[model samples]
Target: MGDRLLEHEELLRELAAVQDWPLPKRMKWAKRRRKEQFRHWKRWIETDEAQSKCARPRKNSNPPDLKFASEIVLLEASARNDVDEVIAFLDEGVDPNLTNIDGLTALHQCCIDNCVDLATVLLEHGANVNARDIEMWTPLHAASRCGHLVLVRLLLEHGADLVAVNSDGQMPYEIAETSAVLLELQEAMEKNGFDDGAIEDARNSGPLQMLSDVKELCDRGEPLSLADAHGVTLLHIAASNGYTQVVECLLTNEAAIDPRDRDGWTPLHGAACWGQYEVIELLAEYGADLDAVTGTDETPTMLASDQNITLLLHDLKTRQLERSARNKSRPRSRTFSSSSRGHSVKRDSVNKKSHFSKRDIAEEGKQFKADADSTTGDVDDVVIGSLDDENGGNASESEQSVFSTDSAEKKALRRSKSPPILIKTSDPIQEETEGENNGSMAQRDNVVQAALAPSTLEGQDSKAELVSKETPPLRRRHRSENTSGKCCTIL
Candidate 1:
């Protein structure tokens, strides 16, 4: 019998090795061999069954090893939704709390999969509700992350810790996306007398403060370094909201100008990304570093768009230039080493001017100023020139002089004329000296100063000063006119 079995095995192995055997021939031979093997196994089983029935074996099919049985039952029960088979096994001596290699129990699987009914059954059967997986995620954490609001509420009501953090340091509420579910879980926790100290910490950390509080601090001139629960400063909050006034107030108070948040975002980055041009300009004016990189290695200037943030950036560049000129005027005995030359070159390239004729512009400006002075008396007919004169002198014909118009006509010409040829030149040396002079003269004009002042007590003083200096003669002329008209009528 052993020899016949060996011969059959040899034949099967030889047939398997046939590279070019026809499919029909291979199937026929394999079928015959399998039939013969089945016949032999049937005879052996029948003989054994007869003997086993006669003797009655001591153990019924040798119960699986206790540990292996426990592991298999646990794995199968946790993976499948049907709990009947799992419950039967548990009743038959399988441990309900058996953890796999990852320390995940059946309850963890049920919660993660949102099998609320199965989870309830498991809990009733004494499964640990707070059993943690490999990531130390409790069943409540799994339910919250899965957005199972009912399961989350159930778990919380049953005394699941609301503030328990997973390996990722996120609480159940932090992971939950649905506001309704989060609120329900929170309410359930409160009903169960569970306190979320972490949430209270976040609220008290100034994140929940009224806009008035922020404004009051700004009004009272309080700094913006006030840290919240997560160590985020008031600048961080104001920047996130793009609150221009709040940001301006915080900046004026000398807030930590560019302190990075936990995510390494400075106020300038937030302002730039959110298209808050006013806030961005305020931040830049207060000495926020444009070149400073975020945690993602993106600079504020890199994130700024030409459409939304161009004006802000242009203003920043202008201020930077003004600041550089100011600093240059101050005596600095420090010598520039060779290594520092590269950094200086890079800085200068950022605001480089295109090739243009400043001399021609200066000549045009002189001509325009001479024309302006000559036509001041007849300013009503004096036309201003075009920014681009190459367009066939058409715009030059429209250039009108301001001083040539009569007082009544001048009052009608109260509208501002073109920006006064002052912004056309690119030379910082010339721009600083000339622009400063013009700006200072404009500042001295009390009427212009009063018009620019904010409507406050400070503005009222400015308005009074302006009235005394420039408008007194006009006021007197009106009074004289009224007096003369009254006297003539009486006569």
Candidate 2:
């Protein structure tokens, strides 16, 4: 058998054919060999990965030891409380930092299972002692809540955060129900120099506070953008936790938006990673950069794992693109809209702007037209009377010529006699026809403005001055007309 390598299948068949090696002997021998093979592969992979992490050159090694048919998931191994399997997998280059679907790391699982040995091994391999799961729960939270005293001590000694608040605003010590666990946490806190007052102060300062807490801080005139030791600001905490009102308060108070935490994660990054949908939308509204990268070079968009969050980002991106495009082409569109009519006008340039809605403008236009015609008629009658006075009630041929003229000529005279009220407005008949064809209120206003265009900028300036001078007189007239002696709203 030493002369050449025998396949495992062939070896199994040979063992079966052997009379000396009975069923019990074969089973014992196979178990011993499997353990030896597993141990050998574990050590080799462990060394290679550790060296790689240290930036050292690697040596050629055997492909993964397929001693077992397949490797179990790291989470599954920890959940099963299989210390050997967990260690084997960890040794074979599975990252202790890798999380399952619930964002639970192997350390988290170890704490949940109360597996002190597994937790120790994972920590030795550099598992984060304070790794927060999806609900912002640390391993200490799991162990403390499960009343696993050994696991709690192991985690605390490994530097687990005692006062790290979870999604429900409960800390590890707060959740620690057993007297033993509570006493241990309290002792740890005292040893670490954390006092009751200090803990309470820290908790109050956190962005996870209620609106009333925020209001209290505001009353005290305390600074809004409070940061912890890790440089996590109130915006970061509120955003990650989906506290919309708190986030809005922080923002309205002019708190820093893009402040990065210890890991270069902004509030947006935290919100996206934790699947805070409304918070993500709120951040986008506040102009949070979608492309801001973390220390690991991952963007908020890349960190977003939820379907709704991705959809929200997609919509925000679409709106941003549309807004940019609209802004870029606004001047051109405005220019085109102003000149859509046949005539030229400078409506926007006028100083005395008539702020009127569609209905108000139409009503004012009709009312003004009637007033202008009445004024024209009065002025024409005065001129005709003065001509008659000049001729002394004369029967002169020129005076008689007016009445003798054709009806068309008389109508032309009356039309020409009116002030230039309709100069800015289109012919009423033409405007009606166009309005019927195209019912756009904005477009019709543009046409009126285009026709009202002054011949030159100098002319426009004179028109503005004239309108300014005329407005006070118009208002005075309306006020005098009011029998109640109250100021009339001269529209």
The TM-score measured for candidate 1 stands at: 0.29
lDDT of 1 by residue, 1-491 (tens): 23134467777678668546888987886787777787777676679676787687567565665455676676676688778877787788777788886888888888878888888877778877777775668888888878888788677667787766554446687788688878877776577565657556533433235356877776776665977655678787677555566677666667799988766778788777767767787787788887788888988777775565856676687889899899999997976666866456433342243223445554554554444334332222211111112234334333423223223223223422322212221221122145654664444355334333454223234223432332222100012322221211100
Each model's lDDT comes to: 0.61, 0.69
Predicted model with the maximum TM-score: 2
What is candidate 1's CA lDDT for residue 128? 79
Off by over 4 Å in 1: 1-9, 12-29, 40-100, 113-118, 121-128, 173-491
**C-alpha TM-scores of all predictions:** 0.29, 0.34
Error of 1 at 110 (Å): 3.0
Off by over 4 Å in 2: 1-111, 115-165, 168-208, 331-491
lDDT, candidate 2, 437-464, per-residue tens: 3454345445334423453222234323
Clashes of each: 13, 2
The window of 10 residues in a row where model 1 has the poorest summed lDDT is: 482-491
